[model samples]
Target: SRFAYVRDFELPDRLLPGTFILLRIDGHAFKQFTDAHRFAKPNDPRGLELMDHAAISLMREFPDIILGFGQSDEYSFLFRKSAALYNRRQSKITSILSTFFTASYVMHWKTYFPDTPLRYVPSFDARVVLYPGIREVRDYFSWRQTDTHVNNLYNTAFWALIHQGGQSKKDAHESLRVRFAWPLL
Candidate 1:
């Protein structure tokens, strides 16, 4: 019991009160993982569905989470402003949600990909952000959605250049760079 004082070294990590808390989780090194597992280009329906299922499971488990937004290999969960879960502890909330989502993804993998075998375990990284009001929350989600749309468009064009236009990887990148360049001659 003498060593219990070590607990005092832990810093206080409570989130701001009267603020909406968002826990966002993203797949770590998922581009390589997806490539290794041969996920469909631009987007994979199975992977997206699996992420949605995992998010739904988390929402069900933590009723305080009011909304979830997901695309590609990332998801954002928004908690009610009045939620007192874990006393709004940052580390506790993020760690639990990340672990739960990752476990749920692995557990439900077979259901989504019955024919494709899992090559290796997948993991996710998480962060907790606080928004002072509903407007900020809406802006955050809008930013994420816009990011998804822009990324999808770029990836589709990149892949199309490689597969359809017979461009090498480097050439495809160059093509996109030129196309995206400002003040084109």
Candidate 2:
């Protein structure tokens, strides 16, 4: 049958083995989704806790995960480069990671927020990046941590201006722009 030819289009290419693989997954449209669901601002303890639980579940379910690092709505799962899971196919790896993480998040959400039902569907996107050496992996983690720290500071300041300083959203954003313009000493 001519229609059966469509089934053969699946692409399969094994990623090169023998390198550190980092699969990072990030929430899609999380800001608006969080706002619609009324998540607490600055940092949501319940949300963060849910993320941690999901990451732990991933590590337990897949023994190949060496470590899991997460901040906010994103998590990075580290796997030994030698793992042959899914034949090291990029599409398979990324799709599975994203789907699994999203499922975990949804499954754990009710435990954290019992009364609040998920108002809408949630999803995550994932990518696999290879680090050739220990130094690059170290730098990658350092960079992620630094990024989280700066974002936290900026968000904290932004929210403080609204709550404590009694400034409007626009004003708070403007203030942040000016305050963060100078480099840290």
The C-alpha stretches of model 1 lying farther than 4 A from their native spots are 178-185
Q: What lDDT does each candidate get?
A: 0.91, 0.86
Deviation from native of the Cα of residue 52 in model 2, angstroms: 0.9
- Residues 30-97, candidate 1, lDDT per residue (tens digit)? 99999998889889899999999999999999999999999889999999999999998989998988
Question: Which residue runs does candidate 2 get wrong by more than 4 Å?
Answer: 1-8, 181-185
Q: lDDT: which candidate is best?
A: 1
Least accurate 10 contiguous residues by lDDT in model 1: 176-185
- Cα lDDT of candidate 1 equals 0.91
Clash pairs detected, candidate 1 = none
Q: Estimate, for each residue in 114-143, the C-alpha lDDT of model 2 and write its tens digit.
A: 978999898887899998888988888887
TM-score for all models, in order of appearance: 0.90, 0.90
